[model samples]
Target: MRQAVRSQFTAQRAPWALHRRPFSTSYTRSGYADTLRNLRIGSHTRVIFQGFTGKQATANARDSLAWGTKIVGGVTPGRSGEQHLGLPVLPTVRQAVEQLKPDATAIYVAAHQAAAAIEEAIEAEVPLVVAVAEHIPLHDMLRIHSILKTQSKSRLVGPNSPGIISAVGKCRIGFQPLPCFSPGRVAIIAKSGTLSYETVASTTRAGLGQSLCIGIGGDILPGTDFCEALAAVEHDPDTDAIALIGEIGGIAEMEAASWIREYRSRAVSPKPIVGLIAGIHEVPGRVMGHAGAFTALDEPDAKAKITALVNAGVTMVHHPSDIGEVLREKLQGGSSSRQGILSGLGFGSQRRQMSTVSRRHRTSAQRAVPQQKRHLYLSTAQSVGLLIETDRTIRSGSPAATANSQYLVGVGIDRSSRMPCIIAGHPLDVLSEGHLKRFPFDFQRGPVDIPAEQIASHLGLRNQQTAIDSLSRIIKSLVTIFYEKEAFLLISHLMETDKSLTVVSARFGFDDAAFRIAGRHQQLHEMRDAAAEDPSELEAEQSGIVYLKLAGDDATVGTLVNGAGLAMNTVDALARLGGRAANFLDTGGKATSETVKKSFEVILRDERVRVVFVNIFGGLTLGDMIARGIILAFEELSLTVPVVVRIRGTNEREGQQLIARSGLPLFAFDSFDEAAAKAIELSRR
Candidate 1:
């Protein structure tokens, strides 16, 4: 991978364009075209528009054509056989390909029809597809994504996005402003389309121009992820430094940080990355802006994302203006307060009036010791009695320990021989001898003062016993269970012991399973294993992977759209719907005639796919995509299994028109329940 020049400015004028040069092919495959000067966008590229007749589609198409896009044709079922802006229009993508033989497509359909449009594009064998619609249904997006994954050669950009622009050449395929952008040495990748413009504006302001500006979509499941884009940037020589703009959603930032660390540690030529993460407001369960923008876990929030990138040594900024300043500092090694001042300005009002009075006190809690650390010891004289008593405690909180001890001692024991003795428990014994060597105990602080003398006395003795037993339990049963399952041992001990023993045991088990379970349950309970009729049932089972088959109806498409979001929801819904999906497949709206054909081919290709549910919502996608797919499957692939489809939305009338025209026996439905029911029924059949 060649390193692109870092644009430099003299504060009085814009930087000059770096001379074009070829980059090693290694980086090209990683999609880091922005870092190389001579990175080429193949001229053989072909294009199809899903909603080619729409105003937005027409305007973008005209601009794209003028910008050197090789748009082959478009799909508008009802308007098929017509011409728009001098581009031929076909009823389906299959027909367009037959006419134009193009390799890429741009979908400018409505959100509702986004899934079908994408599916159609894929079927046509277009290597790349970009969707410019926003608010596409989550499920539909996933189905389209599944199709993309199956056909790895093809890539889908977004159901909501500004799209991609290759500075190496004039390949403007989406809705980003071209005037503010110029091909240079820097690669700008962002989550927000508008923010991408802001980033480019800042770069240009700093006399640094972009090599390529790619909006990976604000949605969670975009065609390209941060890591994918970064890999591309890393390989481009023309790119001196990369600027990344992320938002609150997913672990992509963290993942990128890890990858960057690995790459740097491996002595790879590291490109300095400037990171900015957006979205600080708390909006539970609602994606910000893009349908796929969502945080699955709390740690992936904006603050955490910034921290991760900062820790990874990337330049950080809060304001768009600071972007240029940081880039200049990194490239030129100059003092800059761009980030600090911008952040201070952005946070000024809130900081000025901020109050800590109402803020909740935060504290770090210690982790529980592993079960292997919880050692129990008793004098040999009282071993038998202690065993009986300890057996009771183990039975309650430590079933595994109790069971193991029982198995070791033989299942049956004579009660008369059982003599109780002093026993102690400590959950922290798992720490190494080195840790215990530095154990903190302020013995001079004189055992903690207690209001209750009885409780205090018992605690003191128990503490001593635990310390002694920690070393003494080298022989008697040394049991280790996960910290989480320690309750069983604690509960059994509490049930079988007196107040003094309980106090001593509790002290050793302080902050252990006993406390945790008690806190959650609000009751001291004994753990008991459910009895099985057959002992064979108790045999341990090895872990194995099981693949599931996921099918959807129109409603499912409406609910989940982004690939990741859709995959998550599909897996969750399948479990909820009393079945499981093997993998995710989303035939995007405006799926060309060929994409529809290929989708079935991919699904049937999966041996694990015992059944398939064809979920379609007629939104941006015409029923033609689904209808053509079914017809193609039967005609070319000879598919004979079960298939169910539910179509509704924009071009729905045309989609239904195709379905009626095809005369195929597709299980169709108007409602989600009906579709789900049909899918379930077909799977059973």
Candidate 2:
């Protein structure tokens, strides 16, 4: 494969574009993994544990050792002559350095003492130090960062982080749960810890293994930001692709976007970036667990950050589950066509690849199908519509066959409304500027009630019915076919008033829309496993609900929740409290008792799950209804593993009373943190 890619790179040499050569195809697939392994902390580097005698440090150090990290020794304030897990302990970092010559230090000291420990490591000249303590005074962190910026040689990762892991290297530092990560070529750099875990697990399940994963910390002042880590990944030999996980917080994601934009503007071959920002659905000013998670009105937030990155040429994934598949598409040569086009133009490398695969109507038969070209759009907005550009061409299956034609498709969407339409100019240009203000219609504000005559007149159409009739014909044949059972399918055909342009439009369910657009038949086949039992079982699988079954050998904890953000929070807490999540189910709004029972029954079908964690923030779905559903499901499944439940919001009192009378060994709590901690404790048992 390497040789083939090298040959392709050599053969593509347009003499005039020599200086604009993009990367050889092998660079993204294999060369990156090699580079990253060498640039970042290698598996062979020696590691030392600071505050090694503490309980948290001891547990993490043992796990790191079990994972094959090279732990040379340990440092404790007063346990100089003692040992931990058969490793020698020294009183201070200076003495440990003198004796062990360790390459890096993992600090597990208390919050107040974290600053001094970090300063000690820096003064001792350790190459890297990962501080896992939280609650360090703000001033102390400012001082520590200052030392890192000007006075120290050490690179600090976090004062409140889960640390870092090199999957291929088999090295684990900090407290990240090792089972969730797998060895591969992609690397992740995230500000939030649990979210990073979710991404790694997703990547592993998708069969796209990770090279290195870093929880860079969720602090107001992380020692490192996306740019620094990205630069490192860019140079690392072990990483082939990158996933940047951001949240609704500080300007770290924005800064990373700016850096990537600038990097692409100058570099010959830029790495493919999968950018994801959590909290798109979160309310403003509401902090979501992490200390650095508060968003300002003027800050980029999830929407602005996603748009900026998308505009700057990053592949944006709205959910964590999409990271692996998207990365796989780019790595397995799907992105080569765009690179070929860009390299030919002396533009270095393209920032984003244009979709080229045509749609597959279905895959129930075995036969050759003609390829169809498509334009793809990824949005962070809750809903979207589009204005598209299209044309038709004619072809015959055989020389003796009569002439026949198929439509040539080019599509784009208004950034604001996400409406589908046929416009007069380039699709990308139209999308970048959103809808045409002069057209005088907002597809997003409400129903598209503009009379057919008015729309026809605006676009200079001679007759509204003629265009509608033509559009209806196209819709009857192609647009009405449903991809998913619950899909709200709509197809539109449009013609220019001057009779020069024609286009078709469709609105797709957010899930799997990309795959439908890209002609990934094999992936579509894999999605059939998760179909809903029936439409009325809305609570078990609401239209708004999204269930992501993790890819792993075994399942442990299954999350049942009312909101996506809450699901994520439960996962994060599980990781922090030393738990592993096997699957996630988001019930969206208003789930009934029947929905709850059916959902639990579905979860129990997974043999790996030892426990179920339910967190409900009742709104339209009352707490009492949730409690009743749990009782019903508990009786139906005859569940053996612990069922931990957390409930709040409407009918909180009645809900508690009903759960108390269930006579099951079920545990219930009103706090997310307490419930998560208990769930993890039970899962470990």
Candidate 3:
């Protein structure tokens, strides 16, 4: 079987790109998994768009068509008899289904409108539904899940997703950048879009083309998760390995790790799984850029996530750039003819090359640990936890010629108390920016007493009285700036000759909040590059509500939600239903009923908004408070325009009751889908 595969591969100039891909799959196929054939989207899979004629849909369609995807047609309400991007457009999914008989429907609708579009496809019994929109309301997705359970015909790809792409099949369903992809035997499943792109690019360049790449979406709740994608890949005959990219958020990575471990245990020859877990340096209790890029205090961080994968027999990597080289080292570095085929594809002597260099560098650094060292400084707007090896982190540059060099020092504030505390001689010689994981000398918040003698003793400055005094004065200034200017300071590169002491480099970081506050902070605020920023975002920041005016004139629904995650979700829902939001307004966790009224004023400030969609989950802010605020806003603003309120959680029933009796042109809904549908309906009117 191996000889036959090699013979077929050797005969063809480009076996991967050729239509006759007659490679033997006997080794990788363990024959123990049940997966949908739809998981591997093929070149022949006919696709239709849900929100066919929208600007975003048209633009994405152009890209898909160019990428050789089988785009049959699309569905656009009120624009049924139109042609977009050389494809026929219908009014409804059923109409497109009846005409095109599409294998899948790629939903380009807004997030708020996603439930309706997805439901429409499910009703049409489309085989697969790919939702490209982000931030579909969690409530709406929960309902979508319930409805999906009622049937098995429709397999959903994403709500906040980039969608699924089969590089070998040439079938592109989502909005993935097409140029970086190539046809190969490795399947990719990632929660992070940017990382997925990097992996695809890296693997493709390393002559390890991809079979399929699935972006499961970085929402708190994705439509199709890692386990499902993994099952599908495991069953795929084309795929020989897997790249699972997860992050520090939910238990999704842990669950995937468990599944991989269990499956590998039972299989005859399980495929190699290379895992990469993102968000290693994120601050605790803070949500990163992505909606789901957050970890609970009790949940596992990056280290734990990585450990689970490694325990599961998966080769895990810290960065995406390392994935391809590692995969090649695992698969094709041996003596077998098929294994040696990688050399033909230009992966000749570069396997494990970097790791070897890294090992050598480590050995050299370790040897020099006791001989020489220099100060290192690192600080940001937020305090970061770091594991600094005083010896290893020394600059690779040749150490200064001395029996004993300078000690490393870190000058920063204690995150717990926001006080200035300098770590001296143990690793301190000069003022430098860096943080390490450990308890050390403690100091008070207001004024840190850094005497000249203490500096001399800690930094080993030979007690040069004037130099010590200057360093002491600099430390005092840094402490003053830390409290008064709300700044983070780190001074480094202390050049000390027998006769002289001079400061070489220094970095100061200002707190963003300080700029928001009035007075002397205004000078720091003026340093901002205003032209590069979005004006609406700045205005929203000033109003104490997080607001971002979405691009495109088609945004008709003004979105209002409590949390940033939910706000993006609402916008995604609107897009899913073929509607758009004028702006993203997060009323914040501290919002009151009055905040809702004011939020309405801000939403109304966007003249494009025909209707306001208030989708608030009353976890931090109560539902009744949001509802009461809606009524107040309707009265205060004399809002004749429609308001669709989908408020759930604490006192949700009371909130719905208030809206029912107030009778202020407001549509209240217990179900998020129903409310978003109503908002899209009213937005159209």
- Residues 254-274 of candidate 2: C-alpha lDDT, one tens digit per residue: 667777888888878776888
Task: Report, for all candidates in order, the number of backbone clashes.
Answer: 77, 23, 27
lDDT of 3 by residue, 476-512 (tens): 4444344444443343334444544433333344444
Index of the highest-TM-score prediction = 2
Q: What is the clash count of model 3?
A: 27
Could you tell me how far off, in angstroms, the CA of residue 185 lies in candidate 1 after the best superposition?
Answer: 1.6
Off by over 4 Å in 3: 1-35, 333-685
Candidate 1: residue 604 Cα off by (Å): 57
Cα displacement (angstroms), candidate 3, residue 269, comes to 1.9
lDDT of 1 by residue, 1-685 (tens): 0011111111222111122121111222434223222212434456677788888888778877887777777888877668888878988877877888766678877666677777776666566677776555433453454444344445666656778777556676787755556666678877766556656766777887887666777664576677767776677667887888777655667667766666677746577778777654323333333444544212244555565566566676654445766787778866566523223223222232212111111111112212211112122223333333433432222223432121111011001111111222222211111111111111112111211222223224334333222222211122111112221122122212222222112212211123321233222222222242112111101011111223333212211121222223333344435655544444442355566665555556555554566555433344556566667777888767766665544344666677666766666665444665666656654
For candidate 2, give the lDDT.
0.57
Candidate scoring better on TM-score of 2 and 3? 2
User: How well does model 1 score by local distance difference test?
Assistant: 0.48
